[model samples]
Target: MTKTVLVTGGNRGIGLAIAKGLIANDRRVIIGARDLASGMEAAETIGAEAVELDVSDRQSIQRCAEYIGPVDILVNNAGVLYDRRVLQNPGDFDVSMATMVHGPFYLIQQFEDHMRKNNFGRIVNMSSEWGSFSEGLLGPNAYGIAKAALNAMTKALSAQLPNNVKINSACPGWVRTGMGGFTAPRSPEEGADTPIWLATLPDDGPTGGFFRDREPLGW
Candidate 1:
């Protein structure tokens, strides 16, 4: 059976690559983007369905869930990055937090019922290496803090599910994308591997773990 997969912010970047990888694996892919036009174009290119979704908006997330019923896989790939350090401007912190933390939390809540009823699901949160408290990075403080919160959510949800579902976080290292910019070392294709792996995990796979390139990393 073809699994129903939903990837938020999948119109471009690592999300797009992971969506394409799922398509190649014969899964029914749904690409969620804030822009309908771009989302539709991307879905057309990848043979997936497109749904309008702005992760920062709870209503949009609900609408997307209603549009794509009973998703077997949820890839929370929508995140924002503000290049300001924590002390630089405290005002902009909410913007990063809303997208990276609150948005994915809402999405997971909206789909939890479906997952529980189906008795099988995978939840993959696209986190970042900077989110690791051990990483000790200083820049993009808001983004890192929000993602760290997301990682915490991953662990919480994993515990709650305990059976019939797996929840994990994937850190797609700095990849060359519109968000990652040209100076980044890795390509989108390389960055997508980890998320794709988490999204397609088997029943025995690890949950509540942070991973990169298919290997668990220190949190």
Candidate 2:
């Protein structure tokens, strides 16, 4: 049977790239966008299903869980990077945590049981090198802190989840997405490479690990 994959923040950039790639691989792909209209447009254009999902909102996550059907793979690619650090915009920290850390946990809670029942699942948490303590948590406005928490979440849940239910964190590197900007050397497709790989990991694949370019990354 074909697997279904959900890619959050799939209206643009790396998320969109992952969605498109998964569809090309014969997976039933669903793209989640914060705006319903935008999501529908992108889905129609790309041949993937669309859902209105603002991961920061628990109600939105709940609604999606009700309507999106069973998802075999989940790509938690939704995130925001604040231009200013906490000193300039403390609110950025909250938004960062809500979108990247808390939201993903809520999503896992909603989906993990279904995944377990089916005895197969894959979860890809989009993280960053900045999330690594080894790298000094360098992202601005709690971006690194949020991703670090996300990475920690991956590790914590992995310990208890069934062996077939794999979860891992991926860093897309300096890609030229809207967030990464045009000056970045890598393209969105390049950024998506590792995330897509993680999303499609085999039953025996490594779990609760950090990776970039499909190689292990230090926590």
Candidate 3:
């Protein structure tokens, strides 16, 4: 049987590419977008389903869970990196954490039971090397902090998840997407590669680890 996968922020950018790649690989994909219209449009183009999902909103998350009814794979690929950092716009910190950290946490929680029941699941939390403390947390202050927290959550949750339901964090690198900007060296297809790989990991695949291009990286 084909597994069902949900990619948040799947209307565009890295998320969109990931959705497409998975579909090509024969997984049943559901594209989650904050905007229903654009998400449906994207889904049509890719021959997948689309749902209105604002990761920061618990109601939206629950609604998505109800609609999809038991996602075998989840890609917490939704995130925000406002030009304004916490220092520049302190409120932006809340927005950043809500979308990147808190949102994914709740998403995992919402799907935990369903995934557990199936005894098979895959979760890939999109992260960034910019969030790497080993690298000195050199990215935009808020984005860096938010991603670090996400990495922490990935490790913490792995301990509680079923062995068959693996969760791992992935840094897609600098992909040329709306978030990465036009000058970025990597293409969307290239950026989606790692997340796609992690989502389809075999039973022996590693979990609770941070990786880039399929290689382990310091968190």
Best by lDDT: 3
lDDT at residue 20 of model 2 (Cα atoms): 92
- Tell me the deviation in Å of residue 14 in model 3: 0.5
Which residue pairs collide, candidate 1? none
Could you tell me the lDDT of residue 202 within candidate 2? Answer: 76
What clash count does candidate 3 reach? 0
Q: Give the TM-score of candidate 1.
A: 0.95
Cα lDDT, model 2, residue 191: 93
Q: Report the lDDT of model 1 for residue 151.
A: 86
- Write model 1 residue lDDT over 49-145, tens digit each, in one string: 9999999988888888887777889999987777867677886688777888889889888887878887788999999888887677433778888
Model 2 per-residue lDDT tens digits across residues 1-219: 999898999988899999999998899999998998998888887899999999999999999989987889999999998877587787988899999999999999999998999999999999999899888888765888899999999999999999899999999999998888899999999999999888888767899899999999998
Give the TM-score of each candidate: 0.95, 0.97, 0.98
RMSD each, Å:
1.4, 1.0, 0.9
By TM-score, is 1 or 3 better?
Answer: 3
